[model samples]
Target: MINDKVLAIILGGGQGSRLHPLTEERSKPAVPIAGKYRLVDIPISNCINSNIKRMFVLTQFNSASLNRHIKDTYHFSFFSSAFVDVLAAEQTPENKGWFQGTADAVRQSMHHLLRHEFEYVLILSGDQLYQMDYDLMIKAHIKNKAKISIATIPVNAKDATSFGILKADDKNLVTSFVEKPDTSLLPEWNSDVSNEMKAQGRNYLASMGIYIFNKDLLIDLMSNPDTIDFGKEIIPQSIHEHKTLSYQYEGYWTDIGNIDSFFEANIGLTADIPEFDLYNKSKRIYTRARMLPTTKVSGTTLNKTVIAEGCIISAAKIEQSVIGIRSRIGDESTIINTYMMGSDYYQTLDDVNNSKINIIGIGARCFIKNAILDKNCCIGNDVRINGGNHLEDTETKTYAIKDGIVVIKKGAVIPNGFVL
Candidate 1:
């Protein structure tokens, strides 16, 4: 908590169009990550671990799933004053539009949040996957007596151009800020990699979009109606006047904005030495605790996989993948490099006699390679889903498939031995 007040506003209103089919029916934050968790869970879990109880999720586009998930999972009724709530965009007399950007989302919710008595208000993006001890950041904020603190992380010269790069002085005061700078017009800062670095300086801090705002300053800035976003306007505009501090973070943090990044983050878990360890005992990542039984891997030979609770794996081979709770795999099925969601639905697969065809959901025998299977999909036995032999192409029509992997939407059924 900055300045003795503790209230956090999570900006989760984005449509997440980049995620395409996954975000077709749900908000970006509600989209499933690593099969067992949603994107929004990361930030909320971080807040709970930080000991910050009061959180408000501000969303607008496709919030049904997100709202429902929040209701079913986060229910802390013990604390009357501190709670977690979802605030949607409502038409007011003064404002007649949806949230235009990050700052706009907070400005829209100012009616309720600004009236409350809080010292510091934290604004975080719900789409990133990382483990942070916000209490440490808050303590540093109080010690420095800073008006605002932006969490920054160092990136290579090539990556710095794609992000909102920040420049801080020796005293940790922000000196320069630019969003997605051109590589050709960057200056070399490090001597060793000056020639190798085509972009700006070799060492630069990129904004994580995580902020700790003094409540008064946040309210005053939002009231002005001139500032648009913290990175694009507010922070840079007030860098000289306000004591804006840059908090450096050297940990695992992925924005997971596009499909490539999302897929890469999930597959990273299977690494022998993963950068982000979910099993860290000191900093527990909290999520909706499921009461399902432990996953049972039968005679299947599995390697580099994260299987959640209540999963019953029969005779099958799973490699470099993540399986959600209560999901059952039939006999002689091969699941290769794919993520499957969990469900309690059970069906008989003893008669299943297919190895080359990879299956997704219960009793489905599917033989898939480098494909993303949606939840609750039923694949038939002997159904070869080889969209392509090449790994680069995402679409495959050899077996009448549109994409490299056959995307069976939620609750879809594939007949027995049906290809594509």
Candidate 2:
């Protein structure tokens, strides 16, 4: 009786070690982006826009925030059959272990997956930043009669080492794959490379880690007891037995896995012309509705900045930054090239006066540049956080410097007159 044939499985809870302080208390997918939405929102919105209503988010590490976001933000209408669900990793008698890798995570949920009615499975990463209509790839798969299809992008040789390089024929069929390939191993443009690729001088096909698989083939491939990762094992092995197609994505796609990469992606948003556009009206990105009031700024010289609702700023020189929801900035503070993740809840005047703990806000006369302030942090007055010059690594119990970017940990309290 079921008509829909595709299933979406979003991979979350991947340790996110590279993005240290940000992922300390929450899962990677739950990490906030564009100052308004979590990284998970990107994939969920893509599914919704594409009319692929069924979804499952796989989670394991620090999933409290991630679970809350999915539950509260993705409630389907009573009249509709579409649903977004979370499948947390569990320790069953048959398997008592954490999700070993990407493939293993899906393999662990096989019991639940097989119970559903679906002909294909689409795997998407939770930390990637981009907009994609997966329905196109699904149609391409059916047209080619492919057992599997991987979404890919063309990258210069300088950027190819960070991704999985794939070799495909003119028919857009995958022939080989190499994960985190070296420049020496990147395939040169040959007769097999498609004309659309234009991989002539230094360009190569790099896997975006997006995949679509026939339900039966996916089930059979995950049947192995040793398959740990898709990029590491499954996809490479499948080249010999199945017809694996390649879906070339020419959009702006980025993987924010490391601290440096994360900072770049966020700061790049303030550019005159950003690489990724969040202002698309037809296919907009979706998020939870907080129902908060409008942001208020007074005597602040703001330029090229994006401020979320429920924020109160005063006499501050802010430029090229993203100020998140419920942020409170005192007078004469300067913020540049920064990302301030405001508070989860509003702190009234009574709450601020009564609590001995750190309330969420930056105090007066603070100068923060080239840094990120996590949620619910209390930055005291006269504090100077300048990471533009600090090249060495410093890990205090409260905060740390990774890749020359000062990361103020979540709920951290910095005393007055401190300098970093």
Candidate 3:
């Protein structure tokens, strides 16, 4: 029963620097999403839903949290023919180096892959938020007999310069690829238009950085590459010789590369018609689910928010937020548009005005507007931090809330009645 025809390789090796302090302690894939799931959960869950079982997750850049997450969430035992594993970077005798780029990461792992009998390899990124039926793309690839198939979508022509744009034929065959080209040089520009002023219409198709390749072709190209990227090197060079097709996938796909985008993606999931649904029991998304009691909202006004297990919200007003487990919100505090991480002993018992109360754990607070409070923050009572328009005018490093909310560093405590 040698049925490993398709092998999925997820590239989780990069240290996402663009995400700043969020990635300071954990890998980008390990960053919490929607107060419950991690970034890597999207791809792994998609692979499971698509019926592609044999997979490997490549990790680098402080993978302790990510590795623990994978171990806890993905519990599939390997049989004689099927398995899912996480392969961190290792220094072998032949290649004692770190993964340099996207293409280089795959190149480093080719030794193990070549020994297995797989027909196709699906290469993907770990930082995207999307629900895709990759089997459909695979079927399209096999039907077209394409040596390579790239999943792509239409972007605004002006913004296309920021992405890898593909010039595909009517048959979806990729003719040319431009990686983040200067849009100002376009023929659509006029004399009054500065190169930076060129705006593209929403018609250009950009590569989604998701690729399906014939095992042989992928190995051959990776073996000999000058640059260490697929878009920058392999794909651009391969257009001359191979039948590379572009498969357009129109679904919810977002590259959550930065804190703002990451925040937006999580908030987007709570929409009335969300693109991705974690509540879908049939398409169960796997993550490290901690064992905690059900969330309790006693005398709290919660509207259009998601509260995970082990959370105690007593006498608070919460709206449009995602709350994690074991976090305690104090009475009389108003929480809005925020995300919290769950852990035991995040909050301490406090005496507020002759009454016993549980104060907000680290990073817990009343965010009256668009603000992101990172993990493990203890926000004290009588703290009125505004994320509204004029509240961002203040200039303080630790307390002055920027970008709609104050970001309290992990393990920091805000004393009671503290106003920033």
Candidate 4:
């Protein structure tokens, strides 16, 4: 096991408006990712792989699904002290307000955190994709004798505007930090991209929103009642006041913050050689193990797709997409460049024969292209959802087009012959 000096806290984030419809029913952390796993699983798996036994996920809005997933999936033996628990927002005598931001979420949960005897508190974002050995970051934090250590990744100037760009001194001590810098100002903020990073076409460093804070220092900083966010408020101020150091990460790291990034990440995983390799044996990503039957396919011409367990595909064409568990595709349907978050439960053959309920998936001869179909959605026959033909966002009662990606809201029913 990694040292007992570190405790991990995962920020589940506030209302996930950007990733709406997906977050409409559950918390952001509970949103399904890569077909099988939830967003919170990434950090929890990273901590487990790093040998850190204890983890606390802070949640405020719509946390029931997240709590249930954690309870059912993470079951350490009774003898082991290791635990993964959800610390949802509560109204205490001192603080009755909801979590204002990431820092405030942790600040409100400091009561439970203070009970544990730990030297460093590792803060992580729930909605990110990347495998990390946090023990290494802990070692570097200790070596630097830092009060706070922010993990950063080297990226090109073009891709750095969406993240919190940071500048470090010659010694790797953080000197300046800016949140979501303007695209036009990227050139001025471009710092020394490492030699190896430059060779990889990277020119600036962007924050991964992963930080390790000395226990006492984190407590002291959060004692301020006015502090709300770590990124926009605490971190920008801490760069000059505290011993904030920068730890470089060279691997694949992306914040799945919005629909465009989320869609790209899921679709990217279906690549011939994906940047984030899920098949890595040693560093594995763990999720809820469902006792579902094998996926059955019949005459379907599938290409570069990830179909989860218990799906039955019939004479359909799927390319460069991710199909979730228990998905059902009908005859002669064509799905391309799409991500379908599959249904929760399957409708049996008996149910289908009796016409008991609507089954989730594409109906006969439906054409879906460049879209994301949420869970438990029903598409009638001859329905066409081709977003390539439309670039502007549109919102109707049944569907919404965000970032040029057609999104069928959860549980929405598209009648036959419908076209977008």
Candidate 5:
């Protein structure tokens, strides 16, 4: 009954310019992650694992792929009232503009949300990597008789400066909030955190951008159109006016805000014990059920690599990398510290044989390191790409170099002997 009384609104961030090339063709939530799953899958999966089934994902730009992914992947029982829906920005007589900020997105879509009967509204970010049981937060909100609840994570002083920090009382009631406070202001902003977090030097409570609001309060707040963002406006102003609970969550959580963070999150999956555990049976990440074949590899020395389904890898060596679905790596090639997002569909035999310059995947004798090969890329033979700080930030039609990581654009064709 509690699950039925809760509805989720997932905010697919605006523009996503920080993740340029990746967001070039798709929305931030649609961007692929961990070789196989999309960025949206994280939040959606967390919601499902938490028994919060009804959700509406709000995205504006390049949402076709995101829409398709949700349509194809999430299907509950026909009789069940569980469903995942994508709600793109639409123009009406009252509001004709796009989502200006996080709160605005929810405000614009409030009409659609009101159709469903829910007591609490769980607002989540689409670009975060974490596994959380929101039921616990909801229960806490109910127990505290709070009108709003925010998920807070104890972060060190360095990371605290980059987040919306909150100071909570002994009762875990948010006392004050500051958006990205200066480092000098950190000592005064410390909250009561667990001893483990304090031992790790994570004293300040940082807002995780996860919120829970009573439906009535959210409806009342949406009436005020001036407050467009929760962090900058609604939160700081409302904490004094309303009872806001601070639910502390000490777990592996990362915001995929930029290309560097995105790349690091994917590559981190190859670690011996990844912080974001993808193997937890109780907290499984859901995605489309592609009946892909088992990955076939030969003559490749794989070390700390995670390969998805339908891959044909003959690389001489692959270390600390993630090979996605439908990937083909030619023989004698070496791949290191890379995330190759495998192709969407396999190239037919005739198409492969008829191709003159390059194929859908990597060619023979090539070496790629510290790079990301997007979907359906054609990397020709003898191509060498070594991404590091030595390389300057540049963007070509085919690829881009940001923070020293080479990102091959989607469906890019890199000819033979190409070097970066």
Candidate 6:
């Protein structure tokens, strides 16, 4: 019954400039991750696992792929009220411009939200990687009789400066808030965290950008157009005026805000025991159930690699990589610390043999390290891309170098013996 009274809004971030080439063609939420799943799948799967089925994803930029993914992936009984919808910004008689910030996006879409029956609104970031049961947060909110609740994670001082830090009382009631506070002010902003967290030097509570607001409070807050962002405006302004509870979550959570974090999150899956467990049956990460065949590999030395379905890998060695679906790697190639987002569709034998173009996937005798191969890439033979601190950041038509990681653009064709 509690689940029925809750509605979820997942905010797909703005242009996602930090994620540059990856967001060049698709929305942030639609960006593929862990080889097969989209970034949006994280929040949607979390909501579903928490029994909160009604959700609306708010996205504006390049949402076509995100729209298609949601439509194809999530399906429920025709008679059931459960559904996931994508709400892109639209020009209206009242507001014409794009979403100014987080609050603005939800404000513009409130008309559609009012039609649904809900008591509380659960707001989530679409670009985050984490697994959590939101039902517990909602329960805490009800028990504490709070008007708003924020999911806070204990972060060390070094990591706290980049987040909206919160100071909570012994009762877990947020007392003060600061957005990306200076390092010098960290001592005054410390919150009482678990002994385990304290031992690890994670003393401050950082807002996870996850919130639960009473339906009435959210509707009231959205009326003020001046307060555009929750973290920047709504939260700091309302903390003193309202009873806001802090729901502490100590889990494997990462905000995939840029290409670097995104790359690390995907590659981290190859760990012997990954912090973000994909093997958990109870908290399964749901995605489109494509009838894909098992990945086929031959004589490849795989070490700490996670390969998705429908891959044909004949690489000499693949170490610490996440190989996606429908991938076709040629022989004698070596891949290390890479995330290869495999092709959308498999290349037919006729096309591979007859076409005077490079094949879709890695070519023979290539050495790719510390890179990301986007979907449907045509890597030529004998290409050697060794990414490291030695190379400066640069971008070309076919690929980009960010923080020493070579990212091959989607559908790009690298010439034979190309070296980076």
Error of 4 at 58 (Å): 0.8
Which candidate has the top score in lDDT?
6
* TM-score of structure candidate 6: 0.99
Model 5 segments more than 4 A misplaced: none
The window of 10 residues in a row where model 4 has the poorest summed lDDT is 351-360
Which candidate, 1 or 4, has the higher lDDT? 4
TM-scores, one per candidate: 0.87, 0.95, 0.87, 0.96, 0.99, 0.99
How should the candidates be ordered by lDDT, best one leading? 6, 5, 4, 2, 1, 3
Put down candidate 4 lDDT per residue, 329-413, tens digits, no spaces. 8899999999998888877778776654666788899999999998889888899889864568877777888888998988898
Tell me the tens digit of each residue's lDDT in model 6 across 1-420. Answer: 898999999999899999989999999999999999999999999999999999999999999999999999999999999999999999999899999999999999999999988999999999999999999999999999999999999999999999999998889999999999999998899888889999999999999999999999999999998989999999999999999999999999999998899999999999999999999998999999999999999999999999999999999999999999999999999999999999999877888997685689999999999998999999999999999889899999999999999999999999889999
Model 6: residues with Cα > 4 Å off, grouped in runs:
none
**Measured by TM-score, how close is model 3 to the native structure?**
0.87
lDDT of 3 by residue, 180-227 (tens): 868774333111222333253446667888999998888778767465
Pairs with backbone N, CA or C atoms under 3 Å apart (clashes), candidate 5? none
Deviation from truth (RMSD, Å), model 5: 0.8
Q: Return whichever of 2 and 5 wins on lDDT.
A: 5
**Candidate 2: regions farther than 4 A off:** 1-3, 187-202, 353-357
lDDT by residue (122-211, candidate 5, tens digit) is 999999999999999999999999999999999999899899999988899999999999989988997787789989999999999999
Task: Evaluate all candidate structures by whole-model CA lDDT and list the values in order.
Answer: 0.74, 0.87, 0.73, 0.89, 0.94, 0.95
lDDT by residue for model 2 (314-377), tens: 8479999989999999999999989998989888788778747565789989999989999989
lDDT of 1 by residue, 244-311 (tens): 88887778888878766776788788888888788787666666667777778778898998787878
